[model samples]
Structure formats: C-alpha cells, structure tokens
Target: MDQGTQLLLILVVLLVLFLLAVIVFVLFSVFMKRKNSLLREQIETEKRYERAIAETQIEIREETLRNISWELHDNIGQLLTLAKIKAQNIEGGEEMIEVAETIGTGLNELRALSKSINPEAINGQSLIYSLEQEVNRFNRLKYLSADYELLGDAVTIDSKVEIVLFRIVQEFMANTMKHSRASKLEVKVQFKADALEITALDDGVGFDSENLFEKGIGLSNIDKRAELIGADAKISSIPGAGTQLKLIYPLE
Candidate 1:
C-alpha cells in the first residue's frame, strides 16, 4: 500500500476503536445506574413492608388495650362500686366511713385508667381533648402537676398519627410518674402551617439521652415508630435537667 493510504487507513481504524471504547463506557455507566436505581427501589420496598408490619402490630395492641379497658370499667369497676356501697351501709364507725371513702377513690382511679387505655375513647375525640383528659387525670390523681397547652390554631390530624402521638406521650408520662419522680409535667401541642409539633417534658431527674438504648427505655422504638409515621422524634435529657421529647409531624 502507498504510505499516504496506509496512514489514512490507520487513522480510520483508530477512530473506530475510540468509538467502540466510548460505546462500552456508555453501556457500563447505564448498567451501573440501573443497578443502583433497582437497589434503592428494593430498599424502599423493604422499609414499606417493615412499616406495614409495625402498624398492624400497633393496631392489635390498641385493640387489646380497649378490651382490657372494658373489663376494668364494667366488671372490676362495678365490683368495686358494690363493695363501696356495702362498706358505706355497714355501721362500722369512722373506720367504715374512711374505708368507703378509700373505695370510692379507688373506683375513680379505675375509671380514669379505663378511659386512658381505651383507644376508642382516645380516637373518638380531638387530640387536644384526649390530651386534656390525660392532664386532668394526672391532677385529679395527684400523680403530678400536669399541664397541657395548645399553640396556634387547632388542626385536624390523621387518626393513626394522632393515636401514635398520644401513645408516645402516654409512654413518656408513665415513665415520668413511675421513674422520674417528677413533680411537674408539661405537654404542648402546636399547629403550624406546615407541621404539628408536640413537646412533652417532666421536671424530674433525667438520664443520658445518648445511651438511651443501654438503659432499655424503649425510646428507641418510639423513634422508629415516629419514622414509620413520617414524623421525627427528638428526645433530649441531662442529669437533673429532666427529659423532653419533641415530635414534629408534617401535615399532609
């Protein structure tokens, strides 16, 4: 072949090889992108499944609580009332009067507990109303100086989110009453344009928020549940400064 023709042929071959390399690179990039996209979709699907299972479990738990509440209100509460009546009727002197009074107090407590645990009672009303009932019960039972305040205008919330929020507050309150030795508790609900904010705090001894899992407080599970509901739970605590949980739920 002539020198000029050989050079031209070599240039054409080089160009063709370069084009083939580009094609291979493009195909590899597209394949990687698709693989990554599929992986993300799979992860999202697994998360959705997990959330669904968790929600189902929560529903079952609430149902059980409702049944227990009914038992307490109807059977146990009725029995207590009957005993109180008998105690009041017997002429056992001042001791009998005190006994009757005590029984009456017990009956009131049972009624409060039944109402608190009943999911229908909590879900049948507004979130504010349900929370108000909890705060009132605390004050009535002298469990603590509980206070509830609402900020901004009240907004309608999904029933599922409302129940989860209420349960989270209930768990925190129970922990405070049973372990925190807190004398005062405060709960605030704020309705903003874009979201709902709930804050619950107790003026009691606090623990390390960083090591919450080590303490087995179940607040971690609360965090997970909040995420499942597309809410954010931020729990903070300092020794002697008490504990606080701030939940932010987006309004849809």
Candidate 2:
C-alpha cells in the first residue's frame, strides 16, 4: 500500500477507537445514574413504610387508651358512684359516712384519670395543659410528689407530635411509679427557637443504663417512637441515684 493510504487508514482506526471509548463512557455514566436513582428510591420507600407503620401503631394505641378511659369514666365510675350514694343513704352510721367520703375521693381521682387518658382531651389541649392535668392528678392521688414545669413561651405544636410526646412521658412516669419507687417526679418542657426539649426525672432507685435493653424498661420503644417523630432521646441512670430522660424535637 502507498504511505499516504497507510497513514489515512491508521488515522481512521484511531478515530473509531476514540468513538468507541466515548460510547462506553457515556453508557457507564447513564447506568450509574439509573442505579443510584433506584437505590435512593428504595431507601425512601423503606423510610416511608416504616413511618406509616409507626403512625398506625400510634393510632391503635391511642384508640385503646381512649377505650380504657371511657370504661373508667362510664363503667367503673358509675359503680363507684352508686356505692357512694348507697353509703350516703345509710341511716346515721358514722362508718358509712366515712366510707361515703372515701368513695367520693376515689370518684374524683377516677375522673381525673379518665381525662388524662382520654385521647380527645390530649389532642385538643396544649401540651402544657395536658401535662399540668397529669401532674395535678399524680399529686392529688399522692402517687408521688410529681411536678411539671414549662420554660419559655409556649408555641403551637402539631397534635400528632403532642400525643407521641405525651405518651412517652406517661410511659416514663408509669415506669417510675411502678419500678423506680421514686419519691419525686419532675417533668419540664422548654420551647426554643429551633427545638422543643423535654426532661423527666425521678428521684428513685436507678439502674445501670448501659444494660437498658436487658432491663426491658421500654427504652428502645421510647427511642424508636422518638425517632419516628424526628426527635432525639437520651436516658441516663445511676444505680441508687435516679433516672432521667431528655428528648429534643426540632420545630419547623
């Protein structure tokens, strides 16, 4: 072959090779982009599924609580009322009068409990108000010296978040009452510019926080619920000292 023709052939082969290289690079880029999109979508779908499940669980729990509150207010409450009425009617018996008064006190506590457990009440009122009712009930019943405080100006909160937060606090308080054998319980809510912070502390005998899962104190459940609502939860305890739970939730 002539030198000119040979040179032209070499240049054409080089150009073809370059074109093939460009095609491969473009194809790889497209594939990678598609793969990344799918991966992101899968992650998002999983997150959404988890959130839906959490919400459903919350709804079911609230419904159950409401039912219990209704039963307390209607059934057991009626029975107590009837007993008190019968006691009051008993003729000139000092013991019967004392029994009547005791029954009245029991009725009062039951009413307060029903209100506190009622989902409708919690959903309708501010977090501070709900917390106040809970604290007042605890004090009235002498469940322990319990107190609730609010710091900073109150801001409007979503009802869903309110219910979840309230449930978390209720769970902690119940645990404290049942297991902590604490003499005092304090709960505080602080509204900040960017976040809402909640603290619940009990002066009860504490346990090893490092073995929280082993203790089965519902800490994991609390953490999971907090995560679903975009909140951070921190719990600490020192044996023979006390246990404290702090939760921070970002505000939009």
Candidate 3:
C-alpha cells in the first residue's frame, strides 16, 4: 500500500477505538445510575414495610393489654378478693387460720399484679391520669425510682392519648427494670403552645439504639404511636450511659 493509504487506515482504526472507549464509558455510567436508583427504591420500600409491621404490632399490643387488664379484673382480681373475704370470715380452727394466711399471701401478689395490669385504681385513675399520675405509677413500681417534673399547667389529655402514653412509658420502664437494671428513672412533660413534649431518662445499662430500631418492639411502638399522633419520637442510648425517649405531640 502507499504511505498515504497506510496513514488513512491508521486514522480509521484510531477513530473506531475512540468510539469503542466512549461507548464503554457511557454504558458504565448508565449502569451505575440504575444501580443507585434501585438501591434508593429498596431503602424506601424497606421503610414502608417496617412502618406497616410496626402498626400491626401496635394493634396487637392494644388487644393483648386490654385482655390482660380484663382478665385481672374479672377473674384474678375478683377471685383473690373473694378468697380473702372468705378467709377472714372463717370460724375458729387451725385450718381456717392457715387458709387465712394463704389468702393473705395470695392477695398481696394479686394486688401487685393488678396494679401493673390495671393501675387505674392504685393510680386513682387511668395509668396516665395526668403527667403527674404517670410519674407516680413509675415511682410506685418496684426497683424503679422515677423523679418527674412537669413544667407547665396541668392539661387534660384524651383517654386514648393517656392510654398509649401510659403504655409506652410502662414498656420503657419494664425494659429498664428487666434489662437495663436501672435504679433511677426521670420523666418530664412540657406542654408547648402547639405541642406536648415528654422525655424519659434512665440511669441504667443502655444498648445500641440503631440495632433496637429494628428489633425493639417497645421502641417501635413508641415510634408508631408518635406517628399516629402527628408527633415525633426520638430515642438515644448507649451501652453504659443509659437511654432517653423523647415524645412530642400536638396540643389541639
């Protein structure tokens, strides 16, 4: 071939190579873009699924807690109280004295269980009568010392809100007693103009909150309740410094 022909052939080959490189680069960019989009969509979908599951769990809790309360009231509570009355009425006999002692022990346990299940009585109202009432229930609980401060006028909260808040606080306090092994529980409620804020702080063993976000049923319900109430929930905890649960809700 002539030299000019050779040069033209080389130029054609170089153009084809350049085009091939650009094609590969464009394909790579498009692939990366698609991959990122897919990842984002997956994350969003996971969040939606988590929220749905949390709602279902909340419903289940409501049912279970209600049943427990009724069972304690109708069956366990009434039975124990009746037995105590019968024991006190027994005529002179060693057997009657032993029966009375048994009744006394049983009554004490029943009282404790009933308080935990349906504290509305010992609490003088529903577990969440006011912010103060909730704090009192917490203080009365064994192995948990709660010091609560209400920094605003006592506002009347709806019964539904009172129940949910009561349960949420109850669950957190239970966790503290069972797992956290904490001694001091601090609760605070502030009624803002447009919102109500509640905080529960414990000096106990905390855990990785990120991990709890996935498996902690109590925390999940707290979050779900906050969402249902058009509010916001936040929890922060480390392994040693203890945990804090913050709930904010609207006033009206």
Candidate 4:
C-alpha cells in the first residue's frame, strides 16, 4: 500500500474507535440516570408504606381503648348508679348513716373515675349527636365553656376516626378552659363530598401559637389521627387569636 493510503486507513479506524467510545459513554449515562430514578421511586414507596403501617397500628390501639371504655361506661357505670340509689334510700342509726355517707362518697368517686376513662368522656348516643352532650356537663365548670355547631348529619365513621376527632375536640376544649380568657367558644363540623372539616374556635386569651408551641403531643396526635385516614390536618394559631385546626378526611 502507498504511504498516503496507509495513513488514511489508520485515520478511519481511529474515527470508528472514537465513535464506539462515545456510544458506550452515552449508554452508561442513561443506565445510571435510570437506576437513580428507580432508586428514588423505591425510597418514596417505602416511606409511604411505613406511614400507612404506623397509621393502621394507631387505629387499632384507639379501637381497643374505645371498646374497653364503652364496657366501663355502660356495664360498670350502670351498676354504680344503681348502688348509689340503693345507698341513698337506706335508713339506719348514726353509724348506719355514716356508713351511708361513705357509700355515697364511693358512688361519687366511681362516677368521677368513670368520666375519666369513659370513651369520649361522654358517650356518643348516636352518629347524629355532636360532643355537645359530653361538653354540656362541663358547662357547670368554672373557667370553662364548651359550645357546638352543626352543618350536616354527623354520621358514623371508622371508630378510630371518631375517637381521633373526639380527642382533638377534647384537647381543644381543655386548652381553652385552661389557657383562654375569652369566654366565647365555637365548635362546628362541616362535611364535604370527600372530606370533613372541624372548627374549634375559642375567643380565649390566645397565645402566640406561631412561636409558642411547635408540635405538642396534642396536635401531633390530631395530625397522626388524620393521617390514619389518609387525611390532611392544618393548624393555624396566633397570640391573642384562638387556634384553628382544620381536618380534611374522605367521607368513606
């Protein structure tokens, strides 16, 4: 072969090698990008699954607590009421009267203890009733006022959801009575096509929630509760302005 031809042949071979190198590099980049993307997707899926499991466990615990509370309120509470009546009617001498007084004290203690553990602190007569019945009893309490409003029928929900909603309201009412100076309080629930919104507004001496508390168990529990049902919860508060918690949950 002539010298010029030989040089030309080598140039062509070098060009082919460079093109092959470029092709390999491109394929490698694509493979890496795809692998990274899949890994990210896998991480997200795992996080979602973890959250779901936690929510499910929380719900189970709430149901167990509720069932026990119901048994205490219904069966045990009724027996205490009957005993109280019987003791009140009993007649006897001074010692007997003293014994009756002791019995009366025991009955009162039983009732109070029942209130503490009884689910809802006041049982839900039906899905139609709000926590108002339970809150009413607290009305007589000084430095505390519980108010309620309605927009639609408060139907039955998953027992866990009900307890969460109930506890959120309970905590709010307690906070108001303990910290709020404003007497006016509002509790209302509005149901949308796919979600339920609950508003608990108190005109109490509102604290600077913006800076005061970040994530307390009370609020965290509420959020965790909403999360269980795949719902979203938002809390807005300001000093001298009451706290507002909006929970959005699907109807089903």
Candidate 5:
C-alpha cells in the first residue's frame, strides 16, 4: 500500500473506534437511568399498596364494631331492662332490690359500650371528644381508672389522621387493661402551632422497652401506623416504674 493510502486508512479506523466507544457509553448511561427509574416506581407502588391495605383493615374493623354495638344495645340491653323492672316489682325483699340495682348498672354499662362501639362516635366527632368518651367509659365500667387532658388550642386535623391516632390509643388502652394490671391510665394531648403530641402512660407492670419491637406485632403495628401519618412514636418502659408511649405528629 502507498504511504498516503495507509495513513488515510489508519485515520478512518481510529474514527470508527471512537464512534463505537461513544455509542457504548451512551447506551450504558441510558440503561442505568432506566434501571433507577424502575426501582423508584416499584418502591412507590409498594407503598401505595401497603397504605390501601391498612385503610381497608381499619374500615372493616370499624364496621364489625358497629354491628356488635347495635346488638348489645337493642337485644341484651332490653333483656336487662326487663329483668330490672321485674325485680323492682318484687316487694318485701331487700335481695330483690339489690338485684334490680345490679341489673340497672349492667344496663348502663351496655349502653355505654354501644355508644363507644359505634363508628360514628369517632368519625362524627373530634378526636378530643372521642377520647373523652372513651376515658369516661373506662372509668364507668371500673375496668381501669383512666383520665384525659388536653393542652393548647386544638387545630383541625385530617379525618384519616384522626382515625389512625384513635386506633393507636385504643391499642395502648387494650394492652394496659389486658396485661398491665394497672389501676390508673392517663392520656395527655398537646397541640402546638405546627404539631401535636400525645402521651399515654399507665402505672402498671412494665416490661423491657429495649426489645419492644421484637416483642410482638402489636408494638410494631404502632410504629407502622405512626409512620403512615408521618409521625414519630417513642415507647419506653421500666420494669417497676411503668410503660409510656408518646407520639408526635407534624401538622404541616
């Protein structure tokens, strides 16, 4: 080959190799970008699915509670009323009078349970009002001495957030009643300009707080629900002191 021809061929080969390298680099960048986008989309889809499931579960549970409340009010409550009336009619017997009073008390408790179980009690009213009713019912039933206090001016809260918070409080109360063997439970709520804080404390037998997440699903559930609402949950306990759960939710 002639020197000029050889030089020209070399130049052409170098140009071709450079074009190939550029094409491969561009393709790799595109592939990486696509992979990252897909990953983000998948993560979002999973989050949405989890949120939907949580909402559905709450709805079903509330519906079932409503049904039970109705049955307690209309059926068992009536039967107790009838028994009390019959007991009242029995004269010259102190035992009969006591029986009537007992029946009446039972009737009163049923009515309260009915009101609490109805989903409307929480949905139709504010969170503060709902918590007040729950605390009153607990005291009336003598299940446990429960108290609620509110601080600061309350701000309007989203309904979804209210429901989730109410459920979380209920879970804590249930745990206390069933296992804590505590005589008193107190709940405090503080409203700030841009956030809200809730603290639930029970003077009961407390467990190890360090392993709370590993203990059971109930504790983990509290964490999950709090996260869904962009809140932070802190649970602490002392073996002899007590168990306390605090949740802080940003309003904005």
Candidate 6:
C-alpha cells in the first residue's frame, strides 16, 4: 500500500467510528427523554387523583353532617319529647320508670353519634380512636359484632390523610353491616416507622374480589380514596370465607 492510500483509509475509518458514536448518543438521549416524560405524566396523574379524592371527601363529610342533624331531630328529638310527656303525666310509677329508661337510651345514642358528626373531631383524634368509635357504634346499634385493635406505637399522620383513611374504613364497615350478613367484624391497625397498615375482616358471605369493580360503586370508591392519599389497598374474598381489606399508607 502507498502512503497516501494508507492515510486516506485511516481517515475513512476514523470518520465511520465518529458517526457510530454520534448515532448511539442520539438514541440514548431520545430514550432518556421519553422515559422522563412518562415519569412526569405519571406524577401529574397522581396529583389529579389526590385532588379528586379530597374534593369527594369534603362532599361526603358535609352530607354526613346533614344526616346527623336529621337523626338528632327526628330520632333522638322524638324520644326526648316522649320522655317529657311521660314525665308530665303523674300516672304510675312503672310509667315513670319506662320514661327514665327511654331517656337513658336516647342519651347513650346521642353520645355515640356525637363523635362521628364532626370532621374536625375525627381529624383531631388518632386513627385508632376513630376506628374504635366506629366499632362501638356498630355494636351499640345491634348492626354487628365489631372490634378494633391497635398495634405498635402510634405515629402522628397528616389530618387530611387521617380523614380519608377513616372514611375508607367507614365505607367498609357500612358494607359489612348492610350486605355482608356477617355476625362478626374485626379491624386491626398496625403502625410502622415508615408506614401504617389497616386490616379489616368480616365473617360474611363473600363475593369475588376479581370482579369488585363490577360489584358496587362503594367498593370502587374505597379503593380510589385510599390511592388518593398515596396508599395501597388490597381487597380479597372467597365464596364463604368472608371479605378482607388491607390498606397501607406510607409516612413522609
């Protein structure tokens, strides 16, 4: 080979290697850009979900307060009115005793319902306390046998998160009472350093978890509300083994 021919071949080889290196860099840059865009899109979607959940929570709380007001007026108020009439009637000692019992029962009902009427009260309290109140209400109302347990040291969580969590559990309890036909229900709350786990189990006639979305709007809402607060929800049920729901919320 001549000197000029050897130099020309060397330059061509160098040019080819430079072109390949440029192609590889461009491909890598494009891939990274696409990946970053996808990640940003995911974050935005989650933010939207959280906002929707918050709005829904507010609406639900308002409706709940309204219902509580009606119950106080229509149910407990009527009981008090009857008791007063019985008190005014100087008929018999047995009649007076019945009126006293009625008054006592109404007072008990009011105390149980009072804790659930205020969103601020729920936010100010620990999640475990809120769950215990719910369980007590179920038992008091003769809806079902409900119990709650708290494990590990309690961690202070965001109030907004607590409200959402409480609402989610409330929905589950309502379902158990109305549809589960189950006699007993249990709720367990576990607090860890990085996360909080809530588990609810009911010994009721269970349905297919795989088709939950098709089952009822309440179930879907329960899952979505948990996700709004950056929590993971898992629901499982067999034909007769009863339904179990687990939610895990990570701490900041």
Distance (Å) between predicted and true CA of 233, model 5?
4.0
Q: What is the alpha-carbon lDDT of model 2 when measured against the actual structure?
A: 0.90
Model 4: how far residue 90 lies from native, Å: 4.0
1-252 in candidate 2: lDDT tens per residue?
999999999999999999999999999999999999999999999999988988998899889999999999999999999999999998867888999999999999998888888899778887888888888878887879998888998888889999899888888887888889899999999999999999999999999999999998766578977887889988899999999999999988
Order by TM-score, highest first: 2, 1, 5, 6, 3, 4
In model 4, what lDDT does residue 41 have? 100
For candidate 5, the lDDT comes to 0.86
Local accuracy of candidate 3 as per-residue lDDT tens digits, 1-252:
999999999999999999999999999999999999999999999888876775676567666765777787678877877887887797958888888878777666655555555634433454334445545655655567888777776577766566667667666766776778788989887777877788889989888888895645356667767665457778889989999988887788
Best prediction by TM-score? 2
Q: Summarize candidate 1's per-residue lDDT along 126-204 as a digit string, tens digits.
A: 7888889888988988878999999999888888878888888888888888878899999999999999999999999
List candidate 2 segments past 4 Å from native: 92-94, 213-220
User: What TM-score fits each model?
Assistant: 0.84, 0.91, 0.59, 0.58, 0.80, 0.70
Clashes by residue pair, model 5: none
**lDDT tens readout by residue for model 4, 145-229:** 6677778755567665666666666666766666667676777878766677777777755665544455342454666666666
Q: Cα lDDT of all candidates, in order?
A: 0.89, 0.90, 0.73, 0.66, 0.86, 0.82
User: What stretches of model 4 exceed 4 Å from their correct place?
Assistant: 1-22, 60-64, 67-79, 91-147, 150-163, 177-182, 192-195, 210-220, 223-241, 249-252
Q: Lowest summed lDDT over 10 consecutive residues: which window, candidate 4?
A: 121-130
Q: Quote model 1's TM-score.
A: 0.84
Q: Over 4 Å off in model 1, which ranges?
A: 93-95, 208-221
